[model samples]
Target: MDWEVHQNPERLVKTFPFANFREALAFAHRVGELAEAKGHHPRLTVEWGRVTVEWWTHSAGGITEKDREMARLTDLLLG
Candidate 1:
């Protein structure tokens, strides 16, 4: 999945590369839509050519199965 697991906060992070800023922004928007529909949100950083997505459960204070499922769904968004 090419996702990195970070400690302390304990989150799943992944960066998706796009051809340009417009594409990256669109991806971020799509991710936002997904988050809203699922009632779960992630931290998204959209740059000129990439979007970084970080998923974690704040209430649980760490990553959870839902976060992993969301990450998998996020990958499917690119495909």
Candidate 2:
């Protein structure tokens, strides 16, 4: 749970480090698949060696239990 909590629009954020751009992009694709399966989406920023994921419920206007669950699943992706 290394996620950062942000207010104003409330969300859970985490940045995962990778060895290279290819690895980072692959991770982002995996996350997209997960989001599609769960019907929940997150903001993903894929960079050269890092991918930042932000999870929030847009309709709810903040973080929710689903967001927390998604964050956990996202962590498991790295493991």
Candidate 3:
């Protein structure tokens, strides 16, 4: 997971694989809940058995430490 940190747009990309669409949506929902709890939301895309999450701090105009935190949280949720 190189996940090269960038300066502009403020986002990091991560992809998760599920056995099926239902599992993917379930994981996405969990991420949404976590985002609400942290007050930091991420953009998500669900396709078939894969879900892609992008985290960015809009106010900072770039990726922040919070983004990585949320990314880890997301991984935990999926796990």
Candidate 4:
């Protein structure tokens, strides 16, 4: 719910900050695991102090309710 949802291409995105690269990478791995479990993958950009996640349904040719839910799950992952 704290994520930024975008239109046009239709996607949900969010950036999570961390203390260091290791922390960011660990979060990214958790996101990866979430994606695998739900079969809904996001574009993950991992950086030293941050990780960005963008969710959209490629099969749907845009964003869908599934993507929104996946975005919600991503939040849960962080929690």
What C-alpha lDDT do the candidate models reach, one value each?
0.96, 0.97, 0.85, 0.89
lDDT of 1 by residue, 1-79 (tens): 6789998899999999999999999999999999999999999999999999999999999999999999999998997
Could you estimate the TM-score for every candidate? Answer: 0.96, 0.96, 0.87, 0.90
lDDT of 1: 0.96
Q: Write the per-residue lDDT of candidate 4 for residues 1-79, one digit (tens) a residue.
A: 6778777677888999999999999999999999999888899999999999999988787888998898888888777
Which candidate, 3 or 4, has the higher TM-score?
Answer: 4
Clashing pairs in 3: 10-62, 10-63
For every candidate in turn, the CA RMSD to the true structure comes to 0.7, 0.7, 1.8, 1.3
Give the TM-score (vs. native) of candidate 4.
Answer: 0.90
| Candidate 2 wrongly placed segments (more than 4 Å) | none
Ranked by lDDT from best down, the candidates are 2, 1, 4, 3
Q: What tens-digit string does per-residue lDDT give for candidate 2 at 9-70?
A: 99999999999999999999999999999999999999999999999999999999999999
- CA displacement after TM-score superposition, residue 25 of candidate 4 (Å): 0.2
Alpha carbon deviation, residue 32, candidate 1 (Å): 0.4
- Tens-digit lDDT track for model 3 on 5-53? 5545757988888999999999999999999999999889998899988
Better of 2 and 3 by TM-score: 2
lDDT of 4: 0.89
